[model samples]
Target: MPWQKTFTLGNKRKGCHLITNEVVNAIQDGLQNVPIGILHLFIQHTSASLTVNENCDPDVRSDMDMALDTIVPESLEWTHVDEGPDDSVSHTKASLIGSSISIPISNGRLNLGTWQGMPPPTVATGGARSRNIQASI
Candidate 1:
């Protein structure tokens, strides 16, 4: 059987946020029943994406934002700016990073690497202020 849950997250920001706990806690009850399985998460919006990365240091998250800003700097000429300059940039970043994550479930816990955790990377000022991720187990 596959179980699915969509949880709300995000706000006005342009960076990566470690929301692993928030996602795991919401699906803890469902996870406990599955001794071995997979936890698949899909972000429901564009312009934001999910990724597993270093978790212990706050600097890493902030650094991620900086890195993305550097890679997708607003200095380039973008065609779609109906919303703002961040519009085209946000879409591009979303495509580059992606919108979903999958993790193995072991003994009712997510089997992530020691330094791995998932965050829906926020990009571009035109992206959604809040977002939702659909977790399927």
Candidate 2:
């Protein structure tokens, strides 16, 4: 049988930060007695996104966020400035990263590597924002 669950996370991005564990745990909790299957995670948003990355070191995530900001700096060069400078950059970041992730479920748990974890949701503003994540098991 396939099961599905939706979750939201509160994120306030100063620049770009990772939201670790919450989503993964939700998926795990949802799949808690499923035996074995595939887990599909989807985030319904463009300005923000989801990813699976190293969760062991906070510095790794910080460095990655910094690098992304440097690579796609918010400037006035984009034509999609109807919203703001961060608008295009937000879309660019979403395109570069992605809005969904899929993982394998085994023994009623997500079969992720020892060093792997659910990356934090990337928020574009300093204010509180919510991400809708759908987990299908």
Per-residue CA lDDT of model 2 for 1-137, tens digit only, reads: 87899888766654445555676666666778877788888877777777788878888888878888888887548778665567777778888888888888888877888888876435654345677878788
**Tens-digit per-residue lDDT, 28-122, candidate 1:** 87798788999999988777889999999989988888888789877799888887788877777888899888899998899999988887666
- Cα lDDT of candidate 2 equals 0.73
Task: Tell me the whole-model lDDT of each prediction, alpha carbons only.
Answer: 0.82, 0.73
Which whole-number lDDT from 0 to 100 does residue 31 have in model 2? 76
C-alpha positional error of residue 49 in candidate 2 after TM-score superposition, expressed in Å:
1.6
**Could you tell me the TM-score of candidate 2?**
0.85
Best by lDDT: 1
Candidate achieving the largest TM-score: 1
Candidate 2 lDDT trough over 10 residues, lowest sum: 120-129
User: After TM-score superposition, what is the CA distance of residue 104 in candidate 1 from its true location, in Å?
Assistant: 0.5
